[model samples]
Target: MSRLMRISIPTIRVVPQITPGPPPPTVAEAVERVVAFLAPGNVAVLTGAGVSTDSGIRAYRGVEGRYLNPNFKPMFYNDLIEDSPRGHSFRQRYWARSFIGYPRILATRPNPTHAALATLMRTSHVSQLITQNVDGLHHDALRTKDPELHSRILELHGTLHKVHCRAHHTVLRDEYQMQLALLNPYWAELEESFRRTGNKPRTNPDGDVELEGVSFDDFEVPACPECQREGKVEMVMKPEVVFFGETISQQVKDRSYEVIEQADRLLIIGTTLATYSAFRLAKHALELSRPVLLLNLGPTRADGLPQLEKMVVSSGPVLQEAARQLASSRLSEDANLREVLEGGIVTSIEDV
Candidate 1:
């Protein structure tokens, strides 16, 4: 049995880790610790935008869990629901910026961290790979390497690859982008020019770039096709991701909790646990007396919590090294099993 499994569960709720623990581990120490923690397998991996930063998606927060771009306001769920000029303008701005930025997100490939996670999943080390990112890069990476393990990934925030109307009419984001291009030919040309010149705008993690000195007042946003067919005046379509102030779907929340409950331990990567949704999972692990390992740089919301180990290091390299060690161990296990089978000592079978 693992050391983590022997820990006693707290009858009281686990609070956030506010006080500091020991000094941060060195890179070597961090790797060793990560390997030992994950070697027991059945680990639940909870990642955030930080994991996708290497693939060119900017994380919303800095190391300390503060917004990286203080001036930038995320599109709110309330803004999308308001039936006023402000809402219309907000919709226009969002779609216009998304039209320009979505292509870059599509163009980016998953990074080393994604590949390492996939390797871990393939080796049966991870019980659940839950990510707060909406970029769908994890899905992309898994499809390429560990296609069978795709079901193990739980996207806490909905994916950017899909768009939906207020009535829940959904469409493929690529098709919607083409529709946007058809509606706004001039902006499409501008986007093409920007791409050609290698002058892409910096985008937020939600796949929208900041635009200044550019007016989106005239930019067109297509209504949902089903809504249009049903004679609805304007059912604005938006990316399927959970907007700021929006609650995650109950189904997703239930699944996330289920995965956390079933795992032996929780491993957090690339996130500071700024959001309660992600932080709660770690708290749940601690509450269950299951160990929580955070492999992220800077301070997390749960930084000082007992039963949680924080390693201040880049997650990519640490994950890569851990995957390597785990893979090697798996090969050794397979060889041992093969040798046991070759010995022909299991000729007799007992029915239970």
Candidate 2:
């Protein structure tokens, strides 16, 4: 009943770094293993989409990640910055999917993974957190508990809750929400239909959805209002988060280094260090003699790196149990969460 784009294209798949087969062998007693590594305070936690999986969001890469889906093709930064103009709107294909996806993101709450990290931060168990996620769940989780926790966290890819003008470099201080619904009345109607039919589009880790056969012809994409008034740009507004082909700002890159330098160890939670943006931080942390500990479900780019002190693989938010143990042991004299060097690999006291 509403104006609609009539184009239909077959789905495409973007191949991620394929595995050679087999995930990292698990170290038994995963919780104790994690707590052993977490003994050293000033630990810097690097999180990824995996951490937020319990919150109903899926990770982009993992044993069962979207990146591994042969039918999935992520929208790159180049695609967003240089797609069909007008209704395409720097590719409102991106926005169109986001239009269907953002509601779940806005409705999501921090899960146990968040609570674990928050507990670490509040008790000074860790000094800082550098997250590759742009979901802002970390901020949401720690905001009330420790008002200053947001200050100690560095979002490498930025966040989706804010908007910006690609041409004007202007930040739209508003809930990611406005432009899509406001510009495309028809798209909004389609979204409502999806909800009503319980056929809501499938969403990805980054909050972009898969609108299999949807067209973008009549979708009215919004341009940077300020830029449009100044005779620049044609309907392209971007979420603040870094898209696939985008680069993290140098200032952010520098601050990330500063944050990394503040900690003697890097504990990567729920990430594969797949992208250079996320991998580089772990690489940098290693180059400076910082020991890296990987806690993820499958193989990571950093799996066999010599700089890593240890690695643990699990399908779920394994750290929740570890955090609970750490919290419970805070006052118990029977706490034996320290790592003991036996013959070679680090072992917990319970090993003996």
Q: Could you tell me the lDDT of residue 45 within candidate 1?
A: 93
The sequence of per-residue lDDT tens digits that candidate 2 reaches over residues 1-352 is: 2211111113332224444544455544667667777777889989987787777776665464336455767666766776455325546677778888887676677766676676667667779998888788888766454457678888888888777776546654344356668878787788788777767566776777877776766666676777767788745667887876576777777887887888988889888666666777788889999878887766676766776854446524456566656666552432221210001121121111
- Looking at model 1, report the run of 10 residues with the lowest lDDT sum: 343-352
In model 2, how large is the Cα lDDT of residue 296? 71
Candidate 2 overall Cα lDDT vs. reference? 0.67
Model 2 TM = 0.79
What TM-scores do the predictions have?
0.85, 0.79
Where's the lowest-lDDT run of ten residues in candidate 2? 337-346
The regions of model 2 sitting more than 4 angstroms off are 1-28, 64-66, 83-90, 143-147, 167-176, 226-234, 315-317, 329-352
Model 2 per-residue lDDT at 52: 75
Highest lDDT: which candidate? 1
Clashing pairs in 2: 5-217, 5-218, 77-245, 223-235
